[model samples]
Each structure stands twice: as C-alpha cells, then as structure tokens.
Target: MGNEDAVRDSLLIRGGFATLLSFLLGSTMWSATHPDDGSAQLVFLSSLAFGLVAAYGLTRPTMMSLPKRATWMLILTVLWAVLAFQEPTAHYMIVALFALYLYRLPLWWGVAATAVVMLLGSGIGVVVMGSDVSVVVGPVMAGLVAIAVAVIVEEVFMVGEDRRELIDELIFTRSQLAESEREAGVVAERQRVAHEIHDTVAQGLSSIQMLLYAAERDIPDDSPARDRIEVARKVAAENLRDTRAIIAALQPRALQGGTLADALRRLATASHENVPGLSVEVTVGHRSDSGALALGTLEVSLPIMVKSVLLRIAQSAMANVRHHSGATTAQITVVADLSAGLVEMEVIDDGRGFDVPGALVGASGRAQGGHIGLMTMRQRAASIGGTVEFGSAPGRGTVVRTSAPLEGHRLESQHP
Candidate 1:
C-alpha cells in the first residue's frame, strides 16, 4: 500500500479498537448496575479487562510475526467465546474479530480462524438463546463484509504496486536518456574543436612553412639564419602533422578513411548486418556543372565538415529506422551539387511512419526523450549551415533529407 493509504488504515484500525473498548466498557458498567449476579458481573468485568489488554497488545507495534499475532488472536477469541455466555453484547465483538483475522493473517489461515471463531460464537448463541434461525445470521454477514473489505484492500495494494513499477521504469529511462545526451554533446564538441584546429592552427603552420621556404630561397647558402629558418619550417611541419592526427582522431570512425562514399557504403552494410530484419542500400551521386545528374558514382568529393555532418545525420536516421521505423528495407543516398557547392543526403525507409510535426515539436522540447534522434540530426545539420527535413505519415514510410554547403572547400579557396 502507498504511504497515505497505509497510514489511514492504521488510524482506522486503532480508532476502531478504541471504539470497541468504549462500547464494552459501557456495557460492563450497565451490567454491573443491574447486578445480575456476583459471579456473572465478575466474569463480565474480567472479559472486558482481558479484551482491553488484548487490543492494546495487538495494536501496540506496527508489525507482528504471524505466529505471535495468531496466538494473541486465539486468546482473544477464547475470551470472547467464554464471555458470550454472560454479556449479551459480547457476540458483536466477533464481527470486529472477523475483519482483523482476514486482514492480518494469510488467506487460508485467516479464513479457517474466522470460520472456527464464528462457529464457536454461534454455537454458544444457540446453546443460550436456542435455534431461532437468526443465530447464524450475524456471524455469516460479518464474515462476508470482512472478506469484501480484505479483497478491496488487496486490490488497492496491487494497483499501488503497478504504479510503483511504472514510476521506477520512467526514472531509469530518463537517466539513460540524459546520459546519452551528455555523451553526444561531448562528441560533438570534440569534433567541432578538431575542425577548428585544422582550419586555424594546422593551416597557419602550413603557411608558415611555405613562407620560410620562400625566405630560404632568397638567403645565401652559408647564412646561419637559413638553417634556423629550415629548422623552424620542420617544426611547423611536424606540428601540422600532429594537428592533422588530432583532427583525424576526433573524426567519426566512418570518415577516418577519408572517403565519404566508402563510409556511406560501409554504414549501409553495417546497418544491414546489425539489424537482421532490415536490408540497406546506398546510392552516391553528383550533379555536374552542366546540371546533369549522375547516380552510382563514387568520385564525388565533399568537405570534411559536410561529410561529418551528413554521416552523423545518416547514423541517426538509420538508428531511427532500425529501432523505431520497423522497416524491412532502407536506402541511403548522397548527392553533391557541383554548381551549387552543396551536398545532400537522404535516408528513406519503407516502414511505418509517424507525425512529423509532432515529432519535431517533441524533439525540440526534448519531451519524454521520444524525439531525441530527430533533434540531434537537426542540430548536426545546423552546425554546417544545413537544413534537414522529414517526410512521413502513418503507414507511408519516412524520408530524412539534409543538405549542407561544402564549407571546407570554401575555406581552402579563401585561404589560397
């Protein structure tokens, strides 16, 4: 049971026992005033005192072992059974005992104990009042009510357990999603820093080496400054190589071989292998300066940044396809436009689709971690002055298209 429900039940049980004690005390005092007989009054007082003590003992601790609880219950039952002969109101206490027995004891044992006490109480009633057909009515009715209450409480406990499980699962899922986002952010920052170093530091070192060579050409052969200039050039060259290595290390594994087309094909092959139910195909193409389209060509050249963004987008798209799309076949397409100085990639899957607007909105807000893949893809594309679009609907398959400028080529041209 939840905390509130448990507390409420505890209060109710304690209050009920208190009320029962009050009723019994008043009934004993009334019997004393009537003075049926000295011995009868003594029996009534003893029974009332025993009941008060038993209620206190049973309700003292919040929890009790089954054996100990059953022992106290047995003692109370026998006391009430004996009191059934003397006090006229003593029989009603059996109803309260029914509730306690069923709630506290295991089902079978509770049922057995309740049945035994009920029979003993009713038998004493018949012996004293004679078989009036109403002898069994009270105990039977109380038993049914106690059973109903126990069932209701059990159902409430079951619902509480289900709610707790769902809450735990949600917490664990959110934790995993947060971890994934952190890792992705770290990787993106590393890639960005690598690209920055390649463009600024590595390029500067190369320029310095070229300038030093030019200066060495003008100097005399015996000049010591020429040797120092050559040494400086070698150092710059070595640093440039080191910078290139760092950039390579930061680059995605798929693009490490320096071939976008090959990397895409490998991605397709890997996706197909990893997702046994899905088959993947890759198409690399280019549009020439003459506006002619050529498909299935691997000679397309793209900037490193463009390749990196496109590959990451493709990875995200394929992941969605493999994990979410429920697709049987998928296709990855890359096309470079020579005239426009842009490259575009498209991932299409013939699978179940979803609401694009809703997905985008959820992704933008990072709600429930449901659309994180789409959000990451958009961010990766935006990093390179690119745009990604999704075309999808329910049962109509999905297409993720992204286009980015060739920034690396533009930078080289400006530098040259």
Candidate 2:
C-alpha cells in the first residue's frame, strides 16, 4: 500500500509539472500570435486553473475511495479538451490528464477516453491549424505507447499486491495450526489426569474406607477389635501417602516450556537440592559434534512429550546413581542435531556398577521388592519414540543413555 501511494504521488507531480508547462507555453503563444482572440485566451486560462487544482488534489491521498479524485479528473478532462480545441499548442495538457484517467477510470473507459482526447487534439490541429501528416501520426502513436506502458506498470503493481496477500494468508494458517496443537495437548493432559486419579487415589481411598467400616462393626474389646482398628489406621495412613505421591507424580512441575539445555539444567539443580553428597554437572555437546546443536544459535526446542520424558528419565537415572552408586560425581549430557533430526541424553556416574540383568529382574518384581526407578525410566523413553540403554560392569561405573529421533516422530524444532 505504501509503495503504491509513493508511485501515485510521483505520477501526480509529473502530471502537474507537464500541465503547468503546457499552460505557460500555450498562453504566451496565444497572447503574441492570436492577440485579438480573447475567447481562446479565456478558455486556455480557465483550463489551466482547473487542471492545476485537479493535479494537486493528488497530494491529499485517500486510497480507499475514488469519488473526490474522479470528480476532479472529469472536470480537468473537459476543460483540457475545450482548451485544446481553441489552441492546438495547449494539447500538451492532454498528456497530464491521460495519467489521471488511466489511474482512476475502468479499463475500457480509460482506453476510450484516451483515444477520444487524442483524436480531438489531432482534429483541432488539422482543421484549425492546418497541421500536416506529422502532427497527426506523432501524437496518435505516442498515445498508444503511453497506454501500453501504463498497463504494464499496473499489472506489476497488481502482482505485488497478490503476493503480499498470499504471505498474510500463510501466516494466519500457521497460527491456526499452532493454536490447534495447544488445544489438543490440553485435552490429552485432561485424559491423563482422569486415568491417574481412577487408578491410584480413587482406588486407594475406597479400600481405606472399607477397612475402617469393618473395624467399626467388630469393635469388641476382647475379640481382636483392637487389631482390626490398628489395621484400619495403617490402611488409612498408606492411602494418604499414596494420594500425595500420586499428586506429585502427576505434577512434573520442573519440566515446562524451554530448550533441551534449560530442562537439563533445571533437572540437575533439582537433583542437587533434593539429594545430599551428590554434585551433578550438566553439559551439552559442541556444535562440531554429530548430533549436537550449536549453543546460542537458532533455537531447537523439543516437543512437550519428548521434554517430559527426557526430564523424567534423567531424574530417575540420577536418583539411582545417588542411592545405589557409591561414588558421588555424576554428569548429564544433552545433544541434538537439528539438521539430522536426532536427540540423545546421557547420565554417567562415577559409581560402582552392578549386573544389568539382575537390576532388570529386580525392578520387574522377580527379585525381592526392588526399586522401579530404572524400569520407569525405560518406559518413559519408550512413550515418545525413544530408547534407553545402560552400560555397566562390576568394577566400572554406570552410564544410562537415552536416544530418540526428532524426525520419525514427525516433530518440528521450533525456532524462536
């Protein structure tokens, strides 16, 4: 819009200058050559005044409406036509009016008007001034050339406007897609919350209520009613504990919107806060690495599902290191390759390692009641097109590596 306005203003100034020049040269010529023709002088002077006013009206721009400009252009056209008939030298004024007509009138109308003005001006020269063939052909050919140039320029402007409109529509479509994805995420989270409550807190509460009811019915002091009460109290306490744990599990508050690096840093900090005698350093691969993203470059963010899984897997791996691994030093590494569409996370600990098969069995309840930390981490990785692997030996330290492909999951790395 701004570019079109600039073009319009420039053409207006050119037209005004042309009309002024025509009027000056024509009126002076009329005064000297046709001194006694007062009527021609009057016609030329009146046309000049109207043409000047109409040309400058271009300066007060109003792109959205055409009525005001159309009125001025129509008046200018009639006056210029009359002035040209009186004095053929004033025909230069028609060139200025042609610009206004081309800009304001419809296609067929503008062409017809240009032809009418050209024929009228040439007719005046031939009939009144006894102009020869050169006068007749020159202006006619110039008029045709001018109309062609105007049409080409207008077509270019129309193409530019169409391209800009397409760009805006594409932007709007992307915004709509982003909004729909957000809403889908919300719906998925709601479903998760419903399932967690029904399976954990709700079921636990129902069991506790039943146990207390049985204790109340058999409340005989001599018939083991005290044992029943104690059992009921224990069940109630366990239920309460389970409920709190379920709430905390449902709320992975540390994990939120951020880059993969930010999520790792926060997870490392939280582990340091919650565990004693453990100092974990979080680091990322250099830009030169195979699957490592460059720091402080175009942001490559992980999906919410991927972010959540990565954070949880890191937390679980760290907890295992703190409790089972005797050594205190641990390192968490994050690497991503946007071009290759790959992401990998590793938690390495300088602690005593154990038999991997035994750990898996113990976690699956095959061995005496064991921690599910490792098993849970594996499940979390698998939830989002990911993998979990451990490297360990009796004397060596443990390294838990998790990897996922950013492309196969059809996830896009958003740039901020």
Report the number of clashing residue pairs per model.
0, 0
lDDT of 1 by residue, 23-113 (tens): 8656754664565666566665667666676666556635656687788777777777767776656677787678667766766687788
The lDDT of model 1 is: 0.75
Give the CA lDDT, 0 to 100, for residue 200 in model 2: 71
Clashing pairs for model 1 are none
lDDT of 2 by residue, 1-416 (tens): 45665666576555665566556555645653565655765764765676566646654655525666667666776776566666666666566656656755555567777888778767766886677986787568767876897788778987886676556544554564465456446534844684567457766676777777777677877767777677777777677667645543443355433455676777678777767677889887533334445654323445546656777678778877767787678899877665656678889988888788888776554332223566656766776678899899876999999987665332233211
TM-score of each: 0.53, 0.46
Supply candidate 2's per-residue lDDT for 329: 81
| Model 1 regions more than 4 Å off | 1-12, 28-35, 203-220, 234-416
